[model samples]
Target: MKKPTPYTVSARLYDLISFEWPVYGAGRSTAISLLDLAPGSHVLDMGCGTGLNFPLLQRQIGPRGSITGVDASAQMLAQARQRADSAGWSNVTLIEADATAVNPAALTPHQRFDAAIATYALSLMPTWQTALLTMISATRPGGQIAVVDMRTPTGAAAVWTPLARLACRLGRSDIEAHPWSDMPQRLARVRSASVRGGHIQIRVGSVGRDGDSVPERDAALDPPRQR
Candidate 1:
């Protein structure tokens, strides 16, 4: 039998206990702003726990746009479904699968997305690099890919390191994962932001054209087509 994860066990209490407004929310908001999504754009949300990014994404994409959210935990996906239904967001699609291993074609059958994002979720996966590569492949050429994750607080915020570490540990995330580190190498025109005393890190970048090579391991994962 598969082991139950914290996400599965805490799906119901996630929003109230996740420290969204006080600490982590800034990171997601900043990444979405950097994406500069146009109205009607299609977006893929990897590791989209409980659809927390839905409200912000919907505001940018409007009613005509669509969101495909993927998560490994069925319990979490259930919560995400409820959130979408309550908001009456008919354009949201939720899928249950491991972000690192799921095929992009399975997420969007007709076309690649205009943008892809993962917020505070990648560090939990041991194969976060594969997840990052998947995000790049799921987007169209020149489309945006954003990753928002956690790390130890820096500078004056270093004083809060213990608390930050505690938060990440409780969530079963690795503060040292630094999943966004590869964004600069894989994507073009990379942009970044740090918030919550440096505990939150955000990176947004654009997918390269056809001649541009994605990492070798990702080559078999349905690389994005050139425009």
Candidate 2:
């Protein structure tokens, strides 16, 4: 099994040290806003480390809606569970599993989710595209699918390129993996945004009905792929 070392070993310190408010938070906030989620909408959060997106998501989803958060790190899920409990959010569900291997039908007996979001998570997986495909399949047709990831800074932000690369390296992410690049081909009504010196990239789009089937390839690799 591939260990999520940063999350597993330092899950508790993640919220404090992850640069949520000053930097990475911008990407999640922007992605959630673009989701255009409706009240009572069921949502899936793939690779939902420490449930950082829960607060913003709950604001829009409300008590009537539900959130299913999945992560590979058990330590991370523990933190997420505590966050939900402390917030008194009974609608939240946290699962320990690889995003690529989770079975949508087994997640909930209810219909497919109204939307799904993955933030700062996909680039860490070698099979990031496969994880994205799973998110699309778990969501209802026409449901929104949003992805937020990172890359080296560009343009006027070029000065921060080294810092950006260093961050990705520490987090065990593929800084060169432009996972969001798949949005145009796999989705509709595609929209995008960038922040943090253009190091963060966000992609949001609607999943078509035909994309709701799991790919034929194996979801769980014998030796989990790495960057």
Candidate 3:
């Protein structure tokens, strides 16, 4: 298999896979449920991927809210645009930029966000720490960051850490070498000078076929097309 630009690999299949697969749907539910905002919450769908979570975010945040979908792929953004146009989602903004390299001031100059969410996108980044930290940086006081990604299984197979090793060997795009397996713990230790908001990170790891939903298995996915 040849390496394709993130957009090329995702454009058609991105929307298809997300909708067709029950995992993405369930995971999105989990992510959107965590937002817990009153109204007018600025939600960031990091790794927005065809804007699968856009509607859910909008519904949670309601009419007073707004969302921005950031993806490194312009092609993916194009597909997302189709969804936005189809649904007439004017509040959702699509910005094409590398997540780790995004300018925080450019994202929200005057105000910070109520929540930041990434579904199945963290593992795709080469520098996930930067990506993760960037999300935290963009958050406002009392805001929350919800990241859902694959976890490195502990002592599975005839291997100890074989999954992570295999992910590394899988090259890059299609497979995630290092996942946010320990985000909850890592976030707890990460000190920020902010006052009102206390950090709460919950790390979950499971060994099941629900890889697509859970974010760890991360196998090559092919979701069906929407009518």
Candidate 4:
């Protein structure tokens, strides 16, 4: 029998209990702002969960842009579908597949995305590096790729480490994963930000035409306000 993923069992109650508004939302918002997407762009939201990033993405991509959301949990995808439907967004597509193993070509045949983002999602997969590489593969050259994930709080915020670990444990994520650490080495012109006392890390970078480094200046965005 297949093991039940954390999201499969908690999809319905996720939004309410996942501490979205209070904690994690800032990371997604900060990452999207760095994406600098234009209208009519096609984006990939890997491990989309319940599509909490949908509204923010829609605001940037507008009605013309399309969103391809991939998640392993059918229940989570169902919620994401409902979110799109309720908002009357026809451009959102939800696919059930593992981010670590999904074929990029299957995601969008004959075309690549304008941008691909995985917000607070990668750490859940033990093979997060593979998933991040897949995200890079799925994006077009000169396109944007962003990742937002969590870690233990830092400095005075270290007091919250236990609570942060608890949250990560519940979500089946590794608080020590530090998935975004690999971004600078993989992508070009990498931009970064942190929020919630560094518990959340955001990285955005551009893909070179050769699928290597793009020769552009790297700058880090000012950290978003901690809540």
Candidate 5:
């Protein structure tokens, strides 16, 4: 058997050690709020990690909607499955696969998702660019995608740099990876918000018909088309 890493060592204790309430939770909440998903809408929670975002996402998606959460860690998925089972959320689906390599078509066999979000997960993937492109490809045209991840603090908040670096090191995340910066080029109506003294960045954008953005007339008239 493989030795456990930070994520796999204690999946059950992740929520407590993750600093959700004071630090990372704010980014997840803010990012999900910006998704603007409607009830019954299908959403994807990339790197769902112990289902930490499930309850918040469920509030927006409701019982009728579904969530497909993908992660590479089996132990983490086990914990996530437990959370879903305890909550009696039949709508939640957990997949054990690498987000960087998993084929979206296999995950969403019938239809693409209405919205997708990745919270504090991308910075850990070396191929985060491919992971993000897969997310965009998995959503329907005009659907929303949100990326929430961290970076070193700015301005006066730079005082927190050492602490931030230490946290990232402990979590096995790249503190310098600005994965959210690529959103504008791939999607339209891109918008962003920063919090925690600029350490966390939230970016939400609508998938464009052409990936460069459809003309207003085309956007109004055309039906969903695969990218």
Candidate 6:
């Protein structure tokens, strides 16, 4: 297989990592771990590139629930649409729009979602804070927000930090791309963060209306793949 380019990396990695996290268990845990949503729940997926979480959500919510995937990248939206079509999923809708700029008028007035989710796209965002506030605004007051990203624990450049830097250096990417440092807390302030999980290095968190003492679970990023 040809190596994935930078522009194509987002779409290419969708399916590969989508089911790998296993949040608490396997794919089942990962899917449920995204949010504590009930059946027939309506969800808004922010920056929902290629709709990685769409399949699990679709299955969980059944035919009655609806999900709208909003992404700024047209290529990603196209890929997501293709994936949904291939899966014969009619409940998923892909829209070419920035998460931060979503207007209530864009969807039906009666289409307020029960929860919103963004997977791995948090760090990729430019203004992650504004993007999150937009996420908060898009949902109902008591709605839930599930966020996942490549998180780095705060510490001086330790062993793994240097290794991560070396990898980025060799790859000509930003070695100091510590994207999750303050973004999670910023998001948590907007909504109480609950059940934070992921490899300890790359954390994913779930934020909702009524959370006070959600525990952080350890998870590793770039886990060695199963042969």
TM-score of candidate 1 relative to the true fold: 0.92
Q: Give candidate 6's error at residue 19 in angstroms.
A: 10
- Identify the runs in model 3 with alpha carbons over 4 angstroms from their true place: 1-4, 18-20, 152-182, 185-227
Clashing pairs in 5: none
Candidate 6 lDDT trough over 10 residues, lowest sum: 191-200
lDDT of 2: 0.84
Please name the candidate that would achieve the greatest TM-score relative to the true structure.
4
RMSD of 2: 7.8
Clashes of each: 0, 0, 3, 0, 0, 4
Ranking by TM-score: 4, 1, 5, 2, 3, 6
TM-score of each: 0.92, 0.90, 0.68, 0.96, 0.91, 0.64
The regions of model 4 sitting more than 4 angstroms off are 214-217, 224-226
As for lDDT, the candidate ahead, 5 or 6, is: 5
RMSD (Å) of each candidate, 1 decimal? 7.0, 7.8, 11.3, 1.3, 6.6, 7.3
Q: Write the per-residue lDDT of candidate 1 for residues 95-170, one digit (tens) a residue.
A: 8888888987787799999999999889999999998888888899989899999999888889999999999999
lDDT for residue 69 in candidate 3, whole number 0-100: 86
- Deviation in angstroms for 96 in model 4? 0.3
**lDDT (10s digit) by residue, model 3, range 19-73:** 3253235545554554455678888788887888887777777777888888877
Best model number under lDDT? 4
Candidate lDDT scores, in order, read 0.86, 0.84, 0.58, 0.90, 0.85, 0.57
Q: TM-score for model 6?
A: 0.64
**True-vs-predicted CA distance for residue 124, candidate 1, Å:** 0.5
